[model samples]
Target: MTGNLTTIGFDADDTLWHNERFFRVTQDRFAELLQDHTPVELDRTALDHKLLAAEKRNLGRYGYGVKGFTLSMVETAIEVTDQQVPASVIQELIVAGQMMLSYPIELLPHAQKAVEQLAASHRVVLVTKGDLLDQERKLAQSGLGDLFDAVEIVSEKTPETYHEIFTRHGEGPERAMMVGNSMRSDVVPLITAGGWGTYVPHGLVWEVEYAEAPKDSPRYNAIEDLGQLPALITRIEDGL
Candidate 1:
C-alpha cells in the first residue's frame, strides 16, 4: 500500500533538513546592530515579515537568494527605522547570508533515513530553490545526494515548474507528490497541477505568507512535520 509513488519530489531547505534556523540566527545578529536607532524591535519575527514582503514585491528582479532578500530587509530596516542605517549594514548581512550555505549542513532527524528508505523502491528527487553554488555545495556536503535520483535547485516553484517535471517524466497528476513546508511555493502549485502536495509545517515559519493562511485553509494537506510523510504517502496512495 505504500509503494505506489513512482517519483516523489522533496523540498530541500526546510523539508529534508534544517534551513530557516540558519537565516534566523543571522537575522538575530543583524537585529542586534539596529537596536539603538529605532524604538521598533529588529527581531527575527519582524525581520522575516519584512523579507517576505520584499520577496513578493521584488520577485522578478531580486528573486529569492539570501543576498537580495536580506538586503531588501536592510532597506526596509532603514526606511522603517527612519534613520541612517550604515551602508555597511547590507554588507554585514551579505556576509551573514553566506552562512546559510557556509555552515555545515544538518539534516533533520530521520531525514536521510526517510529518503534512503523511499529511494529503495521509488524515485526520490530534490526540488529546492536557492543560490546555485551554495545549494549544490550543501547537497554534496550533506552526503545525502545519492539518496535522491535527481536534484533540482529551481528559481521558484510554480505551475510551470511542476509541469516541466511531470511532463518530462511522463508522469500524470496522480502519481507524483511534492513534500515541502511552504504553502506558497510548494503546496499551492502542486495542488494546482492536480498532483498531491504534502505540507510539513516548520516551527519557525516566516510570517509573510502562512500568517495570512487561515487555520482552516484547504490549500493543501498539512502535517506537523516531515516525520509524517511515510504514513501520509501511504494514505494518499490509497486514493483518499
Candidate 2:
C-alpha cells in the first residue's frame, strides 16, 4: 500500500519559521496604546475580542498579513476609544507594522532538514497564504526558496485552492499532501480537496485559523514538528 503522493506542499509562516509570536508582541503594544487613550483600566481580553472582530470584518477587504492586521488594530483602537484614538497611537501602530514586515526570518528547528529530505524524492511546493510581497521577502531571506519546485502565495487557502495548486504543480490533489500549522488553512481544506492533510502545530496560532480536527478522515494526519515529518511520510507511504 505505498503512498500515491507525487507532490508535497509546505506552509510558510509558522510552519517553516517563526511568525505568530511577532503578532503577539505587536498586539501587546496595541493594548498598551489603547489603554493610554481611555480613562478606565483596560481589560486585555475585551480588547483582544474587539481586535479579532475588526480583523474578521476587514479580512475580505484587506486580506491577511501585517498590513491588514495593522489596519484592524487602528480600526479597533478607534472603536475602543470612542473614535478618539490619538494620531500618535496610530503612527506607532503603523511603525509597529513596518517593524513586523522587517523582522528577521528565523527558521524553525528542523525545517530545512525536513524540506530538503522530502524534496529529494518528491515535488516540493510552498503553498502559503499572505501578502505576496511580504511572503516573497520572507522566502528570499529564508534561504530555502530554491528547495521548492514551485511557490503559491495566495490570499486564502481553501479546498479549491489546494486542488488548483496541486494539480498545477504535481499530479493532482489525490496524489499530493499538504503540511502546515493551521488546521483550517493547511489541513482540513486539503483533505476536503482529496489530498492528505498533515497538521504540525506551532507554539502560537492566529485565532481565526482554528478549526475542528477531521478525526474521521483517513487522509488526515498530525506530526509534532517538521523534524518528525520524514518518518511520518515514510509511515504513510508504507500504509502503516
Candidate 3:
C-alpha cells in the first residue's frame, strides 16, 4: 500500500483561495469600532474571546457562516459591554461577512499545478466547508472546477463525512489522503477515520481551531505549500 494512492481530498478556503485575510481586515475594523467601550489592552483579545465562545455555543443552531459570525459578534459585544453595542459596529461586521467579496478568489501560488499533477496520476476531490453558495461560486470562478472528480461542499467534516466521501468515490481509506490547512477541519477527522492527511500551512489560520499536534501522530504530515504536494505525498507514504 506504500506510495500508491488513488484518491485525494483538498480543502478550499485558506488552503486554495485566500480566506482569513478578509476576516483579519474586518477584525481590525471591528476592534477600532469597539475601542470606546473596551480598554486599549482588552481591545482585540476581549472581543475575540467573546466571539469565539458565542460561536461555539451557537454552532448547532446557526452553523458557521457570515450570519453566525455577525450574530456572535453582536452578542459578544453586548455580553462584554453590558450594553447594547452600537448597531453600526455589528453592521460593519455584517458587511465584512458577506464573504462573496471576502476572499481574493485566486488559487494559492501553486494550487493549480499541484492539483494538475495529482489528477494526472490519481483521483482528486475538493472537499471544502463554508456557506454553500459562496464556496461553489469560488470554485466556479477558480477555473479549476473541472479538474476534480468530485467536489464536496460540506457543513462539517467528521469521520462520517470521510466515510461517505471515500465510499462515494469508491476509494478505500488506505488508498486515500486528505490535504488542507486546518487541523480540526482536515487532519484530525481524517486520521480518526483511518485515512492519511497532509497539512499545507497557511499564513493566517482561523484562531479558534489553531494548535500544535504531535509529529509522531500517524496519518499526519506537513508541507510548506501546494508546490511541494507531489513530493510531500511520496515523502509521507515512505513513512518519513
Candidate 4:
C-alpha cells in the first residue's frame, strides 16, 4: 500500500506557481490598448474570441508562452483595427510581454511542501510545456527547483511524451503519477499513457487547457489543491 509510485511528475504553470492570472491581467491591458484603434465600441467577448482564434492558429508557429501570446495579441489588434493599429501600440504590447517574462514567480499554497514530501520517497520531476528560457527562469526563481530530481520543458504533453518522460525518469508510466492543474495537458494524456493522472484545479485556467474530466478512468483523480496531494497518494497506494 505504500510503494506503488516511483516517480511523481508536476506541471509548472498554475500547478507550482501563479501563471494564468498574470496572463489575464495582460489580456485586459491588451483590450485597453486596442480600444482607441477600433472604429466602433469594442466588445470584450468578441475580442477574446478573436484572440483565442489567433492563439490557436499561431500555436504551431510560435509554440507557447509569453512570446507567443504577445504575438497573437498583436495579430488580433491588427486584424480588429483593419491593419491600422499604431506602431506605438505594438511597442506597448512588446513591453507587456517583457514584463510577463520578468514577473516574479509566486509559489502556490502547499506546493513546496507537497513536492518536498513526495521527493523523499519518489523521483520527482518537473514536466511542463513552455518557452525554454521562460520556463528555466521560472524554475530558477521558484526555489522548489532544487527539490526535483529532473526537469522537462516540452513543446507539448501527449501520451507519448508522458510515456517517454516517466520511463526515463523512473520505472515507467505504470509506476508513475502526474499532478497538475490542467485536465488537458496535465491529466488526460497522462492517464492514457497508463499512469496515475491527478488533477489539482487552479481557478484560473487558459481556454486551450480546458478538457472534460475523465471520471470513469480508475487512474484519474481530482484534488482541490496540491495541499491534498500526499493524502490522495496514500489513498491510491492503499488501493482505495
Clashing pairs in 4: none
TM-score of every prediction relative to native:
0.82, 0.97, 0.88, 0.98
How displaced is residue 176 in candidate 1, in Å?
A: 0.3
Model 1, 1-240: lDDT tens per residue? 144567788888877777788777876776776666555555556655765677678767766667566666677667656757776765666677666657888887768877887777667788888778878887898889988878888888887898787666536545677888887777777677877677777777655436223234333577776667777777756666
* Span of ten consecutive residues with least summed lDDT in model 3: 95-104
Q: TM-score order of candidates, best first?
A: 4, 2, 3, 1
Model 4: CA > 4 A from native: none
Model 2 stretches with alpha carbons more than 4 Å out = 1-3, 39-42
The lDDT per prediction is 0.71, 0.92, 0.78, 0.92
lDDT of 2 by residue, 1-240 (tens): 236788999999999999999999999999887887865755889899989999999999999999999999989888889989889999999999999999999999999999999999999999988788999999999999999999999999999999999999999999999999999999999999999999999979899999999999999999898999989888878879
lDDT of each residue in 1-240, candidate 3, tens digit only:
236577889998888878777767766776777778665666577677777889889778677665666677677767776776777776766776664354657778999999998888788999987677777778988989999999998888897899789768846666788898988878877777878878888978776666566367767788899998989777765667
Better of 3 and 4 by TM-score: 4
Tell me the tens digit of each residue's lDDT in model 4 across 137-204: 99999998899999999999999999999999888899999999999999999899999999998899
lDDT of 3: 0.78
Clashing pairs for model 2 are: none
Which pairs clash in the backbone of model 3?
Answer: none
**Worst 10-residue stretch by lDDT in candidate 4?**
35-44
* CA RMSD per model (angstroms): 3.5, 1.5, 2.6, 1.2
